[model samples]
Target: MTRRLVATGLVVGLLIVLLIRTGIEQANLNRFDRDMGVILTAMKDEIIRAEGGGVALDSFVTQLPGWQQQLETIPPPTNSGYRANLLQSVLQFTVEYGKMADTQPDQARTAEMVENLTQAIAGWDEQLRNGPGEAGHSH
Candidate 1:
């Protein structure tokens, strides 16, 4: 029964392809997670250091565009809305921080900006730990 053998071969081939695709997707997801963690943490730390007068905002401002580009370039895992949302939040953070640096906001406003950025970072971290639509996730 050559027909039967060919049918079985086709199924096996398709299963192999599926497995390879799944593995590739998993790898991509892992890379995205690792890279985003570092990027986001660095951003939060830089802002906190600047707010506390531990470091100048000049360096952080200089690095914002690169961070933004990296965020935009990293491809999220398939069907992962949380990862997509997290990237957007981080990108927005960079934009807001850049604007603040340009305008030299008042001390009170700086505090407010830091608070908002902290909350956003915390929320994204929680989502990354928990899943896309978890209780603590706002977006």
Candidate 2:
């Protein structure tokens, strides 16, 4: 009887440990989702500011460094290869924008940039909802 009791207790203990670990993982993922939403919104706002004019563009430029910092704070989960790429794209965008903003890329080019950014954001959102799969890139 004592042996049976000990086995039961061990099983229960293991189940509890598993449950706690799963809960922790889920909480981290939820936190990641919420944080990513905030970052994406900020990215959109930057593009909108660029769409506005010089003052808004200046504001956008000022905000981007903060955005980059915020992004770096949240390292992508090891399970998320696609997410890592999306984050890289965002960082690259900020760097590219800094270069382009200096020379002031033409309005048409600016619009194209915004469009591509929008597509990338949408693609990542889809990936998060569904599952990670191939999203082709170019040279």
Clashing residue pairs, backbone N/CA/C < 3 A, model 1 = none
List the lowest-lDDT window of 10 residues for candidate 1: 105-114
Candidate 1 lDDT by residue in tens digits, 9-107 = 999999999999888877887898888888877877876776664244455677888988888888755556667777777788778777876677454
Who wins the TM-score comparison?
A: 1
> TM-score for model 2?
0.71
Which tens-of-lDDT digit does each residue in 1-139 have in candidate 2?
9999999999999999999988887777767667777887776676666665556556666676787788788767554566666667667776776677667745424556667656776666666555465555310
Q: Cα RMSD (Å) between model 1 and the true structure?
A: 3.3
Give TM per candidate.
Answer: 0.76, 0.71
